[model samples]
Target: DQQVKQNSPSLSVQEGRISILNCDYTNSMFDYFLWYKKYPAEGPTFLISISSIKDKNEDGRFTVFLNKSAKHLSLHIVPSQPGDSAVYFCAASQTNRDDKIIFGKGTRLHILP
Candidate 1:
């Protein structure tokens, strides 16, 4: 069973538009969720995160919304730019300890210029 899954392997959007990436999880024990962005061969960089207790968190052009009841989460990038083209990974983990994280394969976002 995939504890975390990103059904869409890729997404495309035109510049200045909205881009939304989705993620689903089956593990109820996961209490912390994070979104990371990666470009080329670089490691993923943390974009945003939300604790299970919270439903939403935002940082500049990025926003993450968690629906605990549905076990679903999404990352929204507004006014998507060409520079936003990269792979995005959704990760979840149990909080308060040194626990390993479960990550979706990733979604490749292509922003058309």
Candidate 2:
């Protein structure tokens, strides 16, 4: 079984609108949740993150929310821009265990201009 899961294969949104991506995890040991954006022919770049101690974390237009009880997490982008279109991966790590992180398959987001 996959430790991290992104049920949605892809998402489409209009520019200047909001984009939401969902993810789930089976591991309760995960204390840190992160969102990474990846472009073609490039590695994933960190976008936002939330620690288990906090329910939400935000940075500029990007925000990440974590529901530990439900083992669910989500990333929200406000005023989505065309430049934001990319594959987003949800990752989780148990800091106490090791530095290794588990990542979801990823969801492709398309921004319509």
Against the true structure, what is each candidate's TM-score? 0.95, 0.97
Deviation (Å) of 37 in candidate 2: 0.2
List of clashing residue pairs for candidate 2: none
**Model 2 C-alpha lDDT per residue in residues 1-113, reported as the tens digit of each score:** 89999999999999999999999999999999999999999999999889999999989999898999999999999989999999999999998985789999999999999
lDDT of each: 0.95, 0.96
- The residue pairs found clashing in candidate 1 are none
TM-score of 1: 0.95
lDDT by residue for model 1 (21-73), tens: 99999988899999999999898998999999999998999999999999999
The whole-model C-alpha lDDT of candidate 1 against the native structure comes to 0.95
Instruction: Name model 1 segments beyond 4 Å from true.
Output: none
The TM-score measured for candidate 2 stands at: 0.97
Model 2 residue 105 distance off true place after TM-score fit, in angstroms: 0.4
What's the lDDT for residue 21 in model 1?
99
